[model samples]
Target: MRHRVGPRHARRPAPTLLRGIYLPRSMDAGAHAMTTFGIPLLVLATTNSAVLTGVAFALEWVPRLAAFALAGAMVDRYGASPVFRTASVLRALTVVAAALALPYSDGVGATVTVMLLAASTGVLSEFSYIAAETAGGAASRAAGSRAHRVQSVLLGIDQVGTLAGPALAGLLLERYGATGMLTVIAGFSLLAGLLAPRQRDGRAAGLPEPVMKGLRTGWSTMRSLPTLCWLVVGLTLSNLAVGLLQAAAPVIVIQHMGRSSADVGMIWSVAAVATLVAVALWRRAIDRYGLWPVGAVAAAIAATTCLAVTLTHTYTTYLVLIAVLMAAEGGMTVMLRTLRSHLIPASAFGSTLALSALILLAPFPVAGVLIAVTPPALLVHVMTGCAVLQAVGLAVTFARLRAAPGLRTALA
Candidate 1:
């Protein structure tokens, strides 16, 4: 049997430990931001085709849903360290290749190549994301009672990436072409790989099942939790609304609002600031006020933001509303994470969280395709209807969660 380390054993200082954890995560976030913003910008710049831009967007996300369950289950058996390190290295190498090769391709070939890159990047990034979250748990265990504080700091760091990453990418893209921007992104991803820590106790000896069996077990665990399932469904609906904004917002800002891609990056950068402020405000209140109530309020803000977008065409108005929506999104995200932790079993986190993410995120690329095909006027109406559906679904779910007797005790 394994034994615990004694008091005499030397433990790393919290700052040193946190540095090891945050450095990779911070760099990874930068890489993620660059990929998210750069791909669409590169596609549009190359093709000047909205349909192709949407295709690139779809390429990036659709594979994530396909990969998440497998990634999660793989992490369960093999540990996150190797998976993270290998994936980051692959991302670095792939992007480097893309930078060198992409300019040589013809129009049809370029579209196909970029989409393939997006798909591969999507798969690798999903593994990294699951690894980071798992690493956070390890970091928290090391921090002991300060786990919540550690998580808050991590959340803040993520916000910083979102706040600055796009702006940084936009600056680079504006000054340097796609190849230069990709080179920089590859560097960040490489840094993340190099900085990744290998926990001495990272492997899960408990999960020795075959790959397919492990996958099935995870699905069973996730489906058994009705509350969590409902929560995912509600969040999935919210993600569809999010997809509408994400896929449409860039098009709207550039085509409808007559701005540069840099402007769209700036808009997201501003939303990140708003999200940071919201996180600061909501963190304390969530611990005090509980999930359903705070979640309901956040839902209202989200719906209001969607409605405001429908009513405005001004660049400034769209920016402010996106900021508001992102703020609400940040708060709701924290609440949902906390709530999911409460509802999900400890053993099920890896697989179940992956399943949940698959559902919640699947809408992203679908939104892109929808935006691509839908006419502009009709798309606006589709978004408006999405907002209504989001509000109603969240309201009902929160009501159900509030009414459940078992959940009442834990709600606080």
Candidate 2:
């Protein structure tokens, strides 16, 4: 059933190439962007409620958080690439199921069921996402001096997807409604699934450890590194602030600004451009100026931009400021990701990154809860306080990290 190639004919190593498995992973991210952005609009359209929209947004993340430990264990025990393939198929199936349920989405019960089902898909998608990212990190490392450059390319691909996906979703939802848009998302998921298994990372091998054994190894790895542990804590706090933007941005853009879903699309499209520019400049800036200095400056910029969000009620200001704020966040994201790649051993990449991600993202739902309860007028002030807190925290933490004896040698 199988044909063997002669010595004269050999296949190129796609996994060692610049694009590699990261390309499909980026496409999958786009599918994620589509569903995540579409969910709030879909819920708001059906229920005519901002609170429900926030709840729907929160649902997407909750199950993913719940599944992180297991997802990591699975990826580590069985290999990241295969886990990614399985997750992609599951994502495609769920997207199809959710698409089929669209007609009944008008009722509260139906909407709730659909939202929860979407969350289940999110759980699987997160597994695939982590696997892809871990593989991407490996590919970039293999690329040598151009590692950051290759990573920038990958990040650009992801941003392109993130940018186009929501806008396309918005356009599709407006033109054809939820069913048509969901169909598109399902197609993306399916395509990602099909493409994933073609590329294999020689580096993504599984340990012989059982799930709990793997988890304990990852935990030990995380705890043994003081700076990495600090990074997880600091980044998690930073995400608490980021959670506000994620949960409330849609409400602000649509409900408060009196804008359409198309406006949300435009906002992120601009942000995507900003993200590309930021990623391009960030590594070079870090090389010249040092990571701590550049990160501090980025943190200051992000803090200033976020706090500025409270200064005006204008839709244009919110769009521009949020886009700029996200740009700064994008740079910081790459910086942190680089650190993770450098710090975590390849054997523990899946599990450690999973635990780290769980810690970082848990605040999103909390932000959703706050958005539901906090008065709209006071929301801006709360976000401003969070931004200020994050900025100050970043400054203090980075300073301490740099000053710590042996930290530089260890990182080196």
Candidate 3:
């Protein structure tokens, strides 16, 4: 497909690698590192219970099922930049509060309270992210490619931070305690907040209509597009598998394999590094075969690799399988994101993209709960089976869409 700017807006100069791209990439790396690493370690160190850890994870994701629609509406109404900046500041403050509250929580109630607050802030930050990317025109195949490149680089950096954050958290916990580690997280969050500038494009100004109206419009557009809807379905099932695996893997590794928390972190770090390499190499793959085929292949690879994890009896084999799983997930994620951008319209960008999250991420809580209750072996089997089904479903849907004359015309 050819990439072209529409006549409705005059074409601006092509974005530079330095100014237009690298700045947001840097911001994402810092923000993701602080949240992904800090939140889990803080809970693990403070609460120190698997049940509570599961609760914390649930609190973080459960509300996104509902709130994302409204957040998307707000983005469409107010524009993305202001909301993005405001959410970042709020997230930074929330991190600071959780840091402060870490020492005071002696039991489940206090820990739950602190966790809920942190989780809520994370949702807000996520909403802002969806809005910003959508408003930046990251949905078009051409625009999406640029966004994917930025994400690839940022995620590669985030892998480094993932390795660093847990190790740093462990050391800080040993030295200055949980409070010291949290303080460092807060500092990093505040710095990320400070770096956010107003929208580089003028899309952040005046609303075109009421928030409700915009949402309806976006919904109508999405329903009219079968490929996009099926894509959301595929993504939702994929996320369910991921959530189950994440919740179950630690228990399996620790209980079955007799490993320590440090071992879990190390295994995850190996996966992260593998993901970084896969994402770096994925651009070439995308450039060669296009996003759809690459995404389907990646999904199949992910399902098989995750299933292989359940079969491994040795640590070295387990680590290798996990790394392969992470690499496949990383590569698939890049393609899925780019595909979402290509399918959605510019005007309804945030709300439309938010729907993808609403569908995919909303089920995570249930998945986590199932993991907490089910046997590890059974859970692994279920997760792998679901992943295989999702991969097959996505492949079939893509084939059907590709064969449809109407879709071909619309996409053309």
Candidate 4:
């Protein structure tokens, strides 16, 4: 009886801890996705301007990038649970406030209000995300040899949220309106806040340092890892094409293709399924072929699909190409996560992760600006140029990665 009881008690913490993190993270991720997709669509719906939609997209990503370092520092000082819950609650309240104020706002005032909401929520979402990531990192570190398995589960949960949020947001926006959509998003945020688990010690390692200091540590860490640097460069280039397409999606579907918001959401929802399948395959493929070979294939597929997507005029072709492109993106993402878990030392993991995220996210605002300035008809040409660059860049990067000694030793 004592032996059985002791063994059962020892096994209980892992599943319970995972649930405490995974459940709230799922809710938080879904709310974040809804806000991301919904806000740009909202801007388009309200202003009937592609430029404003682009601006809204920039507003969302820029602040999110800016907040990463600070959020990492805060999570280190205050612990993950408190920071996550606070950010979640703040996001919910902010969304609710925006929903209430939108109806009372005048023409320009309404636009300004929405823009403010986008920026604020973007910052808050980053805070919650970083905290959640920190918690997950702690759990992974605890798992020791099974860290990759834990990360795979977390990635799958993120994909599930991505699957549900955009389609639901589009439907609600089409049927009900911005207010209804915002309310639902707020509910999810509130749930995330309520579901946060208490940290065991309620604090992290050291006293909080400046964001710049964190960046310096992260930057130094990146320099030590040449493979990670090259991969970042390739991913950054790929993201430019991906980001541009995402920013221009509403305009392309609704204005150019004469489709509805639901169609816009459907594109992403379907693509997410392909991504999920790709992620699953990536897990198995990595074991048989190793990282470099699998990653090279993914990069090739992504590049080819992006190039093909530029020539697509029909909605069906566009959707299919985007799905394939996203599938490739998903595979590459798994490779990156696996590499990150293995390469980045546990001591600097949070700051380095935040830094890497910031670098990757740098392309989104640039894509937003391109969308704002470029003619909608010529956006395809821009995509073609970006796709060509991505292909070349990824090809070169992977060639180096295949030859890199550091990566070879790490894999060994």
Angstrom error at residue 7, model 4: 22
For model 2, the stretches where C-alpha displacement exceeds 4 angstroms are: 1-19, 144-146, 199-214, 404-412
TM-score of each: 0.89, 0.90, 0.81, 0.92
lDDT of 4 by residue, 1-412 (tens): 4456465545555436556879999999899889888888888888899999999999989999999998877776677788899999999999999999998986998899889988999999999988887778777767765555566677777777777888998999999988999999999999999999755434446668799988888899989988898999899999999999999899999999999998998998888888877787876776566778778899999999999999989999999999999989887887777677767876777688889889988999899889999986788889899989989989998998998653332232
Residue 387 miss distance in model 2 (angstroms): 2.0
* Best prediction by TM-score: 4
Consecutive 10-residue window with the lowest summed lDDT within model 3: 403-412
Best by lDDT: 4
Off by over 4 Å in 4: 1-17, 200-207, 405-412
Residue clash pairs of candidate 2: none
lDDT of each: 0.76, 0.74, 0.63, 0.85
Could you tell which candidate, 1 or 4, scores higher by TM-score?
A: 4
- Give the lDDT ranking, best first: 4, 1, 2, 3
Model 4 local distance difference test score: 0.85
Relative to the unseen true structure, what is the C-alpha lDDT of residue 194 in candidate 4, on a scale of 0 to 100?
91
RMSD of 3: 6.6
Clashes of 3: 2
As a TM-score, model 4 comes out at 0.92
Tens-place lDDT per residue, model 3, 49-76, is 5555556666667765666777777777
